[model samples]
Target chain A: MKLWLTCLLFACMPAWADAPTTPTDAATWLNRVAQATHQLTYQGVFVYQSQNIMAISHISHLIDNNGEISRLDALSGPPHAFLRIDGSVYCSFQNKPSGDIEHRPHHSFFPEVLPYPNTHLNNFYQVRSLGHAKIADHDCEGVLLIPRDAYRYGYALWADSTSHVLLRLIKLDAHGQTASQLTFTQIDIGHAPTRAQLSIDFNDKLPIKQSGNETEPKAVWQITNPPSGFHRVTETVMTLPDHAQPITHLVYSDGLATVSLFIERQTQPNTFHQQGLVQQGQMLLYTRPMGQYQVTAVGAVPLATLVLMADNLAPIERK
Target chain B: MSHLAYANKPHQTDGGHDYIALISAGFDGELDDQELLTMLDRHQSDINASCWQTWQLIGDTLRQSPSTHPSQLAQRVAEQLKHEPTVLAPKPLRAMHTRHMMSLAASVSVVALVSWSALHLALISPHTTQLASSAPASSHAIQIAQIDPARLASFVAAHRDFALSADSPDTDTSTQNTAEPTQ
Candidate 1:
């Protein structure tokens, strides 16, 4: 009777025994990370490594009644500070006369991965939990997002078990080797940043030059063929500092990776240049000349993707 | 305390240090009469038998100085040769006056070929470095010099606001992708 009771007790144990210490559902775990980033006030230093190059930047995020204000100071590079007040960004470089301001929709820097809508993700990626790991002195749950197709890269993300804040991220190539990695070496969460830490001190003499001016020119160009799962997120006209005319810019994203297309009318005489494909680490650049206008596509995607998108650009005829 | 210190206690035959020491000695051919007898006794234990086999393989590797077998090496060589380009014999020299004309034509052809190759290399050279650097082993400097940190900072800041607003259902409808005319 005693032996039977013991066996029954063992079999009747709670289902929580099989459940992971962290959330198993990738969407919920990722959403937790995104929520923590916006709601929590924290300060930390993160290292971005791609290939042989590594850069260290200090970030301080503060939330108040007005909105969330954050500051990023580069510790490794030359004197550079980035201050973001809600959606407006103010950047100050040691060489530049004035800090440039741009208003755009963006997200977290360290844990750049968010739970993008997973409606079509299952077809392209295989998401799984890599169990648990210790990162930056905190116990974290590792999640692996493996790409099923060759069109995209894979990612290994580690989110803090307690706070749900992302601790480490690794971008993997097709062969499963790490292509780039981002990790928070040290983090102090729950501590609010001071006013001075979140503030940007701009040059008094020079006015802030807003890039991608609100004046959005009508987009006459269209991408005839975009890869499946990608959608047009935004279309706007950006008046660059060096150029006299405004360039039409179109942004596309598949909820994970983003690609920007800049269509500029080339009017400079004797400016004929060799134009095609150029790459820097993960970012690929593709340029295609169409009559007097040059179309440049930039993204942190495969070279083939950029080439395809660049080649399929068509001018829309307006009646 | 350290695990190693705890493991070295007396009355622990399961630790297998004695058997490992004997195996090392046997591998080095330094096992004397007493050590050889000790190894023979330990060989009865299943753990020591596995360790003994591993030690034999290690001894064999050390004695032979690790290398592919001759047959395997020959197979690999043959496989490589299959991919290698074959060398053709030079054409027999032509007769006197025709040979002079042929030699002049050959010189001109060689110059044209060299110039064409050089120009082709020059055109493709810059792009090759950009692509080759993508390989993990290549030591290509990050081409982020073109990325203005100031601009990126502004974009990130702008993105923060978008993320915040996008999270809320009520305020989401307010910010439409807007485009104003350039003044």
Candidate 2:
């Protein structure tokens, strides 16, 4: 009688055995991250490391109730820095203006992956709270962004305890190995980020105009043909400094992904069959051919997603 | 443009590092400067030299043809042959655009490819079987030869690009067909 009672007692409390220490409340944590990035004013230095690339970016973001934002990233590689005052993006390279990049607003959900319907994410990734840890000397709550489908990589996020901002993120491949990591080394959250810090120190000096706007007339190319859910936002004609001719630039974005199309003079024959997947740190790129143009589409997305985006680039008409 | 990467670090894997893959990106104007730097960094020797040569070759080909995709070669000439507009004399000729193709794919994805391939050894398309059916390997019992789809799904999932074409006498189609028989 005693033995049977003991066995029954253990069986009745089985739920206790599988429980994790300080389980993360997934929904609450997600809401917290969304709110913090959108509502908070922050300044920090973070490193983005991927398959074969390592870049350090210093960002200062200021957000007010208006939803209008201002930011700057002192990029340590590629020898350029980016500054944004409101909607305009200023690049120190290409000697371009401190204005908008004639580039289209294709599928860029940076700072925050906006317009993202959380419903879709749930289908692809199993959100899990993986206890607590410390990142950059700050206490954090850990959550695993496990892939429910093999179409994309998974991510692990460690969000700050007090503010709930993501302090670190690890992107993993199919074998659950680290493919890339973005982690904050120093951070400060508050109402004001100094204007001095927001200003980009260009060329170790101020930016000098490269020249008069050599920007040719914007191309009227509209991709009357596009993959599903994608739309052409901008089409422009750009002059290459190294190459002698101006090229057509067409950009398209589905609410969450972007594809860049360049139509230049074809300089080679299609003798080589180069297809499949390629990687540069955390970014996966897919190369394919589209009419007359060399379509090379790269994004920090799943290889399948990039491949689909590249394959469906159709010609635009004057509609 | 720095040789420091080659100088400082050891080669991670010899045969697998794909420099041309990234440089191919440069040819299209997609790679940002940092990405270009990283590629140059990892491949400072013969690999880098070969990648530049490949770019030159591609550029020559494109300049020569300036009218089409650099990767769609003489092989797909057959597909282009089908592209020739046929006249249903006096009737309005409609262009079967890419949208139509994708719509067809989305609709059929449910009926033919993904679902039933779960069990059957071979699934062939009702309308088209463009696979050459000659990929060597599977020569065991119950040869499930998929013509286009039930075959196409696995092909799409694995390669992202595929077409179906088959000829008789070559069980190559049988062995290569990606289709699984109806469950």
Candidate 3:
């Protein structure tokens, strides 16, 4: 009788495992995540982990009446903070303006940034549906995203069933290990947030200053051979925080992905990191050296795309 | 999640495989004129989509370059044909006038032929025969620069049915023949 009970339990287990209370639909899931990032106004605490670094950050984001969004964050890494409004980023240090800031800006677009252009992604990646899983204590659905080619890596997303918020995002590397991970330890979605919660506190005693000098937009640096569809967006002469010599910050983009070209005075650490891709949540980073300073470009696109961009860096001096 | 999830997985929104294949074939010389034309047509949407960004990066290089090297008479002619912008000119007006041979030639891909012929007007160049093999088999097609380093490597890889982008791991250099030293 005990032997008979064991066999019955095994058969029931498979059926029981399949039976879940509910799972959120996948097709409508990504759109909900986009809505949470854009429409919902809330402050949340999140944890980010990578192969080389682990950091925690507090983000307070708000969408104002003009629909212009502002994000204030105090990232706990060597004590630096960012007050970013749209494209411009103001990096602050320990409750004070760091130094004479040379704003080297790249057009950073977020939240399905290039919405229309991605219809092409369907050709290369077969989007598959996985039932559901739990992430950050939220009952989340599982999504299996497969790459069509080896040029890029793939990802698995766990989105909250109730709120449609992305609770966990895992970026997979070539070896199938977790190259990067982003999980929300605490989250509040679809809740209204107050202005006091989102705004940064600056001491009234200090004078607020914008230390960047805008360059002439048409300062041309012609590339003899760039990859197809790319053009030189702009170039600026700026100084780095530790270095005295002004470096040339060149930026390039194709409406969707962005590549930065920084020609600075080369420093020690001559053993440069091989063209790499470091992911922290939605951001992807690729760094390479030009004539001098190491050119580090970061965006939401694939690392290979940026590596090719940097490798094909042909020199052009105002022609 | 099972590790296999990461092993063979990719984002559903990552769709540059066909494009990378097209570019590799285009550069590798593996794609025949018909194959090239078919790919160009089929990938019209994708080219404008994912591949176009990288293509834009490559196009910027093409636009600012006369990279067709070895000081070939063919490349000189192609360059002369490229710089005379004819895209904005109304066609009927040019057809009515006989003196605008440059504009008429610029309108047609055959401008490479005229400019090339003019370069070899006085010399018996051996490359003319080699160049004939380089032209698209069909009258209407996207012409791949058979000798350009960027195009040559890519064409060789593509024709061998391999992609040249980050996806494909190995490109055998033993297949490296027929291309003159680019530098």
Best by TM-score: 1
Comparing 1 and 2 on lDDT, the stronger one: 1
Question: Model 1 - which docking category?
Answer: incorrect
lDDT of 2 by residue, A55-171 (tens): 666666777554544443535533334554544444454333232221211111123432222234454445665567877788988777554443444566777888877677675
Error of 1 at A293 (Å): 2.6
User: 1 or 3: which has the higher DockQ?
Assistant: 1
lDDT digits (tens) for residues B1-183 of candidate 2: 332333234544363434444445544434444444454445444343344445555554533445654344432433443463332324221222233434544554444443445212111121111112211222222222222332222122211110000000001121222111111
**lDDT of candidate 1 over B1-183, digit per residue (tens):** 222233233334564665466446543434443443344344423333345446544534433545655444445544444554333224321233245445545655565556656544432232233334442231222232243333233223333333311111111112222211122
Query: TM-score for every candidate vs. truth?
Result: 0.55, 0.46, 0.42
Candidate 3 residue runs with Cα over 4 Å from true position:
A1-32, A64-81, A90-117, A203-216, A219-259, A263-307, A315-319, B1-183
Which lDDT values do the candidates have, in the order given? 0.55, 0.45, 0.43
Q: What is candidate 1's CA lDDT for residue A297? A: 73
Give the least accurate 10-residue stretch of model 2 chain A, judged by summed lDDT: A100-109
lDDT of 2 at A64: 56
Clashing residue pairs, backbone N/CA/C < 3 A, model 1: A87-B158, A105-B159, A106-B159, A215-B180, A216-B180
TM-score of 2: 0.46
For candidate 3, report its TM-score: 0.42
- Per-model fnat list: 0.05, 0.00, 0.00
Q: Better model by lDDT, 2 or 3?
A: 2
Error of 3 at A78 (Å): 5.7
